[model samples]
Target: MSKVMKGLLLVLAIALIAVPASANLVATSFGFPVIVQSGTTSAFNQDTAFASDFETLDIDFPVFGDGFELGATAGVVAADGVALTGTANVLPFGPVNLAFPSISQTVEQTQEVTHTDFAQTNEQAEFAYPFVGVGPVALPGFGFGW
Candidate 1:
């Protein structure tokens, strides 16, 4: 082979062997240290009882920014409660799944919450929708969404 070709092959051989050795597969889990704690919301109420037999799951992540999120919640949360009728993006927590309103129409719902109950003000874990212009006052319902 030519002198240049032989030199090129030798360089290639050294690079192939050295690359993997020097460049160890480096994978580091990067996340801000966050203290895990159960979040709660104060009592909230609605005019009429809208959500019953609801499945509210709160999902908290390890990161947050101005009106944004970086990753999914630390884990799947399975909590249930009643809240107002609106988008799910208004809740105080990170990401929440309110599996109510019967996504599947096949399931038969025998009972509905009556106006007498009206979903009285109650404390729910990680689910609350505060009324605008009200200071720290949350109205009853599984609200907050994106």
Candidate 2:
């Protein structure tokens, strides 16, 4: 048609030829929490004790004849205790994306353990003997020995 119109058409054709065409549209977004926690807690305690005691006595007397007396005593005690504990192990993950259509994954884990033990023992022993007289005659007395 006119000179101005021809020049405009030629410039428009050149611009179209220079630009490259895109067939696919892609968009990406990412967000994560600022805090991440991971830790372990443990504790242990123990207690123990021991004790023992012993006593003994012996006596002899003559009352219008012959008499005898004796006594003995013993004791023992013991105790033991133990304890163990684990609070927890915490692990947390914000988010993970593997591929195409925005796949998200979250993971968390926690664990705890506790244990206790106790033991005790006690023992005791005692012995005694009585005196006897028959018509001014003394009789032998018997008692536990060892």
Which candidate leads the pack in TM-score? 1
Model 2, span 64-111: residue lDDT tens:
123331211122223465444322212222462222121234444443
- Give the lowest summed-lDDT range of ten residues in model 1: 98-107
Model 2, runs deviating above 4 Å:
26-146
Model 2 poorest 10 in a row by lDDT:
68-77
Q: What shift in Å separates residue 80 of candidate 1 from its native position after superposition?
A: 93
Residue 7, candidate 2: alpha-carbon lDDT: 100
Which digits, one per residue and each the tens of the lDDT, describe model 1 over residues 1-146? 99999999999999998875455453333222333446454544445445435444444333346867543322333447644343222223446542322122333344555443222343434433332322344323222451
